[model samples]
Target: MYQLLKQIVTTGIVTEPAPHADSALRQLEQRLSETILKHLGRALAIRHVDAGSCNGCELEIHATNSPYYNLEALGIKFVASPRHADLLLVTGPVSRNMEQALRRTYDATPEPKLVVAIGDCGCTGGVFGESYASCGRVANVIPVDVAVPGCPPPPTAIMQGILTAISARRS
Candidate 1:
């Protein structure tokens, strides 16, 4: 049971429920939403790197930007270089070839930055665990702050991951 709760974890790994659905919590949620909107007012600049994916996961990451689930509403935007990014969005199994690049990206991002590993392959190595060419997971290369799982999670879920990270820091 201890390992089950501590070592073994599901999809995202962390969750927090609002204290209530009543008036005060509702009001607080509204305030939180507004504050998050304000803090995230400027689109969160992000840098995305593919460690060694089969591309199935990358497809889903791209879908987050499609018209329907558009991540822009949360004021998140993908940037090119890690230096300018507030978040590092990593995907795929950790490939030996890209190991250095992943570290370089993480190094380039300034302090207080986050790494959101998207997909089970990126998080726990998923189907590609312990391969000759893979390090297995993203955390093996770079420390992960938040993990958004699925083969590739929906854009809304990605947003939730970001929000949760922000909320945890604030609290």
Candidate 2:
């Protein structure tokens, strides 16, 4: 016990240093907040749908909601129901089974809604193209306002896609 305490004392606090505040990211957050307010006049409510994915894009989306990206600070938040969402953030290749559900979700969202297709799968269907079991890209199932193409796009890219969708809506 004495030796263990001595070793702990010697090791002290061994941890990664806190991340530094990023001015660029802060600016982006501010811009997104303002743009969302201008276009929607309220916080952007998003509904995330996973048609059929290997979960890679979902992880990046989760990271976007984390403190580093601080998506909520940008006045964007995920909601449980499509009825309350201003945007639909769809991920993965559209599977045959989810086609009806995806369509229904899109239909449920009110007018002036936006859709951002995340990852290459959502954009171009990735490895699962149009097939008996797959419906190819998200656009195959529903209209997509913005397509963010990447095997699994980073959080910043996701944010950019959302911003693009909002900006395009005004024009």
Highest TM-score: give the candidate number. Answer: 2
| Whole-model lDDT per candidate | 0.70, 0.78
108-147, model 2: which lDDT tens digit per residue?
Answer: 9987677888999998999888899999998888977678
Clashing pairs in 2: none
Q: In candidate 2, which residue ranges exceed 4 Å CA deviation?
A: 1-37, 168-171
- Tens-digit per-residue lDDT, 24-74, candidate 1: 111012223445545644667778899888887778778677756566655
What does candidate 1 score on TM? 0.73
Clash list (residue pairs), candidate 1: none
Clashes of 1: 0
TM-score of each: 0.73, 0.76
